[model samples]
Target chain A: MTSEFELIRNHFVRPTPQAILGPGDDCALIAPALGMQLAITTDMLIAGTHFLPDTDPCQLGWKTLAVNLSDLAAMGARPRWALLAGSLPEVSEPWIAAFTDGLFACASYYGVDIIGGDTTRGPLAFCLTAIGEVPIGMALRRDQALLDDDLWVSGQPGLAALGLAHLQGRTVLAEPLLKPCLAALQRPLARVELGLELRRRGLAHAAIDVSDGLLADLGHILQGSAVAAELFVAQLPPLPTTADPVLARQCQLAGGDDYELVFSAAPEKRAEITALADHLALPLWRCGLVVGAAPGQLTLLDDQGRVVPINEKGYDHFG
Target chain B: MTSEFELIRNHFVRPTPQAILGPGDDCALIAPALGMQLAITTDMLIAGTHFLPDTDPCQLGWKTLAVNLSDLAAMGARPRWALLAGSLPEVSEPWIAAFTDGLFACASYYGVDIIGGDTTRGPLAFCLTAIGEVPIGMALRRDQALLDDDLWVSGQPGLAALGLAHLQGRTVLAEPLLKPCLAALQRPLARVELGLELRRRGLAHAAIDVSDGLLADLGHILQGSAVAAELFVAQLPPLPTTADPVLARQCQLAGGDDYELVFSAAPEKRAEITALADHLALPLWRCGLVVGAAPGQLTLLDDQGRVVPINEKGYDHFG
Candidate 1:
């Protein structure tokens, strides 16, 4: 049997150029950029609950780090370092190799380094802690949104949910949309660059990543900022040309796993944000406006300006 | 049904004065003390592997943080912040309350703060990431042991293992030693102050914490420093006055879970270390010396100055 140490050395240990001291030491030593604060977040993914049993190890690896990176993006921080702790039922060299390859692929893409971690024998699970950096007091926060600020979302919000529905055999994607939807579901890209730019340009007043569906996560921003929101459903980003309008609307409104940035900004910055969208070649959909302080209330309007009553808000893990 | 967010808000959320931003955000923001390097380490504890199913949630919480703090202690770092990611079988509010209480108890004792974490539903497991700080270039390391340096260990090295033995019904401890031994096993304190002092005073050439048995952990230093070590069995710290010499010797030599600091220093610094020990009111046991560069070879000697053969070196997770 290969020891845990050997397994880590074989698969996870890589040269960390940014770290003062990397693996094999008691701790990995890192120096935050001068005049910056470290942004830290942790996330855990478990087998069965978070992913299917037969999910590819490579995708699992990418999604694990990607989700944590999404959190950093939401905070408008630049990715820097990560620590991964994993539990596997047994040691499989090929699986580990592929998983680590996927993990490093995402890390390299975002310019982050895996500094230290631990591996053990148990049910399949992974917990990752990602560290990033941002200038002091410049982090995008949930409580900083001003009343009447325009609400915007990056990319399509419900594609990943549609993809998940397709995977679960509840809905069949059209041939043209199948590949893109599944890709969205399996390999969501975190909006790190856009987040950094938003902060640097002083555009976004508040921001959050769409992990628990738009309505559910938007509720977080509203409650934190002690405000309400009026969303123009007709102006929301279009779903992937689905035939079923009800299903499309459902996924668009309440689907999770989008990893898109939902942010608020002063209405006057519309032209600048539009220019940013053009430069990045990504859509910046203006979907709503922050109403006055009225914690936890969100109103949705139809194309004809009629109120739309929502029966289900979003995905709730324990509900 | 209690949602994951509700659970976190109810149990894990708290005011973190040391952090610029704590929970309720995408990421916690922290500032490292000026002119210091951040020391980071991650550790995972899984059910049926690191602990018994019936273990107390409170003790589990302490042990979880304690182990990670031990790693920081080994590097001579002062712990500052921690992130916890936990997967529980189900939501049990009482269990969570007790666990968080114990976790905060240890955190407050050490002057550390819980900045952020994640909670999910799955088989029981925990992964904690601890971040600390140390003056640049002052961290004690396993690879810097000088040849002919004295090998020293703090506290009783095998009491935790003895407590484990007692828990397993392999041995019965007398009334007087029962509580202390059990505490040693379940709530081992990280030698934070001692480690910081050791590095600040420049008294130790190399350092490691005894998580694995003495012989096994000592092997890490020997291999890392490319040096050999000779340990005198007679000079080893006395076990809790046990009658079973064989079990006592085995526990002292190869038993793990000590969480005590094992360090190397120059013979010329002996007087200073002794005085430091006196000031701290803790025993500093001198057990061996670093011979010359010869990777991975450790010799054990009896009181008669003759070599003693050993069958087991230390705990191997896969062994």
Candidate 2:
């Protein structure tokens, strides 16, 4: 029902760098640096699957780009150009403009360009392919974390999950405390600058962005790095006023859509990595340590230091 | 239903140059020579919009790359890497396998790589964003086409349109004549090497692929070049066969999905262009003349020296 074109303009369209040929052409042209290669990633968001029908188009655009940029951030690539393919039920100029406007606002703020995209009639859905750059062999991957490495995460956890709870009619929970988490879900900042900085400084051994909830997403890193990780429950960052422990815990463990970076650093390089948070003005939290357990193993400890069984899995497109 | 991952592996996962990253990663990385910038383009195909339901997935894959390649061709770039995003209704593994097979075949044939892509559950749809390499200020564009220039096109026209007619239940379209057109439409070949060769030889003044009908797409070049053009009906490439004049004329003049290059060249360079085409094994046809018709005009001359009006414009995303 919201204006689509306006939504697009308010979020997606913008004048990017001179090297980029932004949207409205058959494809976008981007200029990569010498000795560097182009890094590309794509993800799709279906209306009912990715967001609620009542979700704001502006936020949807932001979230769409956020998720894609998160992928680039995971690889320690600097954001550049993006292509969007949006499926629509009908032609509504305003809605598209708003959506694109949000998209571009985020894109421009992140120094990214909306190169070329497709607009078609179908179920309301959108896909974005983000292209970026990194020096050859410099991209950080999830397979590099080593045992005894300290695992760190950027920003707080469970905010996005709390936001979902609020959307699902859980009024008994604190609203103001969950606002930041909701915003985290809605407008996650792709840590491109931070990611590249980490790689440049040789700070991160492995990196990934939390998308399918911390437990599930981090598992990819665990599996890739062929290591295990142990999380200290007491060390998890808590929202300012999320008084209900049960809600907060669920948000932390089971909620998805937190597009924040989780990376591992050598224990010796911990101080330098912590300085990254201050320099970049982003909150970096040390959440755990890589353990000698077999690959793909993950354990959560509570106050009594007993293991917590994880039964809930992250969102799966097919599941 | 087709297996989702298989669809990708068979259709999209192509054997790329060892210089580029494989498709198994978050992003595909490609390294180009220093000082050469990357040209990128993105296009989407909707089920009912770009292709028909019964349309062969293999041809769709080829045509998809062809159209996107045409964009890079127009820019005078060397095709390098492509990222794919497929949104499917059924996630059928077989269809995806066939589709990806076709996609990879085209990528490998064209010397491009399938770097990274995403698949999702939705209406059957696909989008591809491609990257190519071009030296600074060397890419051909519509604005450079000039007055009194010879307008040229590559390969035969009307075949794709004929093919489309066949697909649309035009049972009347018979003979060896109609088969080529169908093949042309279904398996449109991109003039990748031709474009690169032309750019290397500094041949074309302006260029664009005829995705929209010739009249409409050619108009873009004329308008951008700030000149008028006289399209000679006699100069059009011969129809596949001596079919019904009306159908052939309409198909050649207004039908789209032809991935051939149309460009303007100086009258003096005609022989050289032709020789180059011969060397590249691509058909080059001299179709019209670019001249000052009215400072800004596009004309189509019919038989018997009559000026014909082309009112039915080609495809428009929103128009």
Query: Per-residue CA lDDT of candidate 1, range A107-197, in tens?
Result: 9999999998888888999999999999988999988888989999999888888888888988888878887777777888999999999
Model 1 in CAPRI terms: which quality?
Answer: medium
- Scored by DockQ, the top model is 1
What's the C-alpha lDDT at position B12 in model 2?
59
Fnat across every predicted model, in order: 0.80, 0.59
Per-residue lDDT for B1-319 in model 2, tens only? 2333444444555566644666755566777777777778777788887889777887887877878888898778988888887777775666666676787778877888777777766777778878788987677777788777999988876678777877787635777777677778887788788788778898889888888778767877876788999888877887655566777778777778887788898999988998997898778888888887575487788656678887656555444
- lDDT leader: 1
Model 2: docking quality category:
acceptable
RMSD of each: 1.7, 3.5
Best by TM-score: 1
Please write out the lDDT profile of model 2 over residues A1-319, one tens digit for every residue.
1234434433445566645556544445667777677778888788777788767878888888888988888889988778887877777666666676688778877887777676666678787888788988898887888999888888876778777777787745455666676687677777788888998999999988878788877787888778999987777775446456776777677668887788989999978977888899888888788999678888988767788777665655665
Candidate 1, residues B82-196, lDDT tens digits: the string is 9999888877888888889889989998988899998888899999999999999999898898888999999888888888888999988876777877898889899898798
lDDT of candidate 2 at residue B60, scale 0 to 100: 82
Runs of candidate 2 with Cα error greater than 4 angstroms are A1-14, A20-27, A170-174, A239-247, B1-20, B293-296
